[model samples]
Structure formats: structure tokens, C-alpha cells
Target: MPPSDAPAPTIRPAAPADLPVLGRLGALLVRVHHDFDPLRFIPATPETERLYAGFLGTQLQEPNVVMLVAERDGEVLGYTYAGVEGNDYMALRGPAGVLYDIVVDPAHRAQGTGRMLLEATLAELAARGAPRVVLSTAERNENAQRLFARAGFRRTMIEMTREVEGDAG
Candidate 1:
């Protein structure tokens, strides 16, 4: 039993039936990214929902992927996805896990939902034999950075991008 003041969120693997909420939350994440960097992320469009649905559906089928949802009283508060990757190239040496995406609805912020989702994902990846885990967030996304840092993830790489003025694609 949880404290009387706060309810505990149920964390579990996401199912096909959860697609609708996942799509909505995915769109919210995309919008947030776009807001953080207009040049780097695409804004929500008529096709955005469809694209997110397909992406989530495909990820759910991948054996190396872990997708989880956090819900309280049957209302989904957030979700997360991670995947195991093999290092075929010289840069990375062994099998690693990538914390691909995690999003907690704005209304549900300040709760432990994000942390719960992260811990669950990390445990799943570790159980799968991934020696290390990595994740990235938008440069301006301080909240996400803080969450990752609190989870013991350290800075390992910095990605810098510049637009070529003369190149129009």
C-alpha cells in the first residue's frame, strides 16, 4: 500500500492496446524536442501521429527492445523505450544498451514516474547482458539531463552540429 497522500504508479511492459496513449505521448515528446531546437526536430504535422504509431509498433516487436509504461489508476503517466545494440565497429567495444526515449507527461511532472521508468529500463537492459548504457537529450533539455545524471549516467560524448549555408537539400 502506498501513502495516503500519494498513489503508486504501476510499471509494466507496454502492449498493443497501449498504442493510442503511446502515440499521444510520443507526439508530445516530438513537440517538446521541436520546441527545444526547431532546426533539429520536425514539428508535429498531420502525419506525425501516424509516423509515431508505426515507429512504436515496430519497436514493440523488436526482441532487443524494452518498452514500458507507468500508470496510476489505469491512466498512463509516461512511457520509455530502450534497445540493446551490438558493437560491430571499432568505436564501441561490446554490447550496449541505448535508452532511446523517455517521456513523462507535463501534468505528471515532479512525481517519480520518470525515475521509475528509467530504473526499470536499466534493469531490463542489464539483465539482457548489456555492459553499458548510453542516452542523449537535447542540449536545452535540463530536466532530462538531470534525470539521467541522477541515474548515475555520466557525460561521455558531445554532439555538435552546424548548418551549411550554401547547401540546400
Candidate 2:
């Protein structure tokens, strides 16, 4: 949590000017996940920041997508990215809002920033007519799991992964 003396951050829609910081945060996310399981998560490369920013920039004007940032005194402390998705026959699920990413700068973590971003994102998705919202956390991300559970999300699925061996031709 931030010092009580600190002012609260404001949650608002992300802007073009925020892209550089957003890209840095996105690269942090990649590195953290890669640390958790190098084989499962993609490694952060020199171009990751630019690439991530470019990808998210494309979603800025998407009708069903929402990208938000948490700012305090003109500094962006965190951000979340989400979108409404249609039914997935493979998963046997109906339409829903899928949270793609939620990240807070390491210096700002444990300070209510993540929770604020999540609540704001959920509200945005609900306003967009999503009947339900869903997200997948890294198997090792206990902190996020706790936050999601606290926000009334109940577990519905568990994913399992296995690497393939040499070809059987």
C-alpha cells in the first residue's frame, strides 16, 4: 500500500501519450512471467517494449476493447487491458469479457493500484454489456489469484500444459 500521505491515483482511459510507459510496464510483465517459468512464458527481448506498445496502440480504437491507466500527479502507475469476446465453441462458453492483462509498476505494487485497475476494468466491461468477466492468471501468481477471488470470481477451469517430444513420423 502507498503511504497514507500519498494522493490516490485516478483511473482513466489510456491515451497516446501514455504508450511509452505502458510499453515498459508490458515488458516488465513479460519478464516476470518468464521468470516464473521460462519455457511457458515468452522472454522479453530488446524490442519488447516497442512491440508491446505497437500492439496495444492498435487496440486503442477497437469498439469492444478497453485500455485504462492509473495516474497520480501526471504519472501513470498502472494499466489494464481487456475486451469483450464472443462464444468459444472450443471452451463451451458463451460471450464474456476477457481480461487480457493487468499490470502495476513494481514500485507501485501492494498499494491498491492493481485492485483499483481491476475494479475499474470490470465496471467498464459491465457497462459494455458483458454478462460475465473472465481472466487467466499465471499458475504462480498467487497475489492475483487472491485479488480475483476477493472480487467474487470463482474458479471454473484449470489449464495444464506439456511440451511435445520429437516428431513421430
lDDT of 2 by residue, 64-126 (tens): 999999999899999999999999888889999999999999889888999999999999999
In candidate 2, stretches whose alpha carbon ends up further than 4 angstroms from where it belongs are 167-169
Reference-based TM-score, model 1: 0.92
Residue runs of model 1 more than 4 Å from their true location after superposition: 1-4, 88-93
Q: How do all models score by TM-score?
A: 0.92, 0.96
Score candidate 2 by TM-score against the native: 0.96
For residues 25-46, what per-residue lDDT tens digits would candidate 1 score against the true structure? 8998899999988888889987
Candidate 1: residue 99 lDDT (0-100)? 86
lDDT of each: 0.88, 0.94
Instruction: Report the lDDT of model 1 for residue 59.
Output: 87
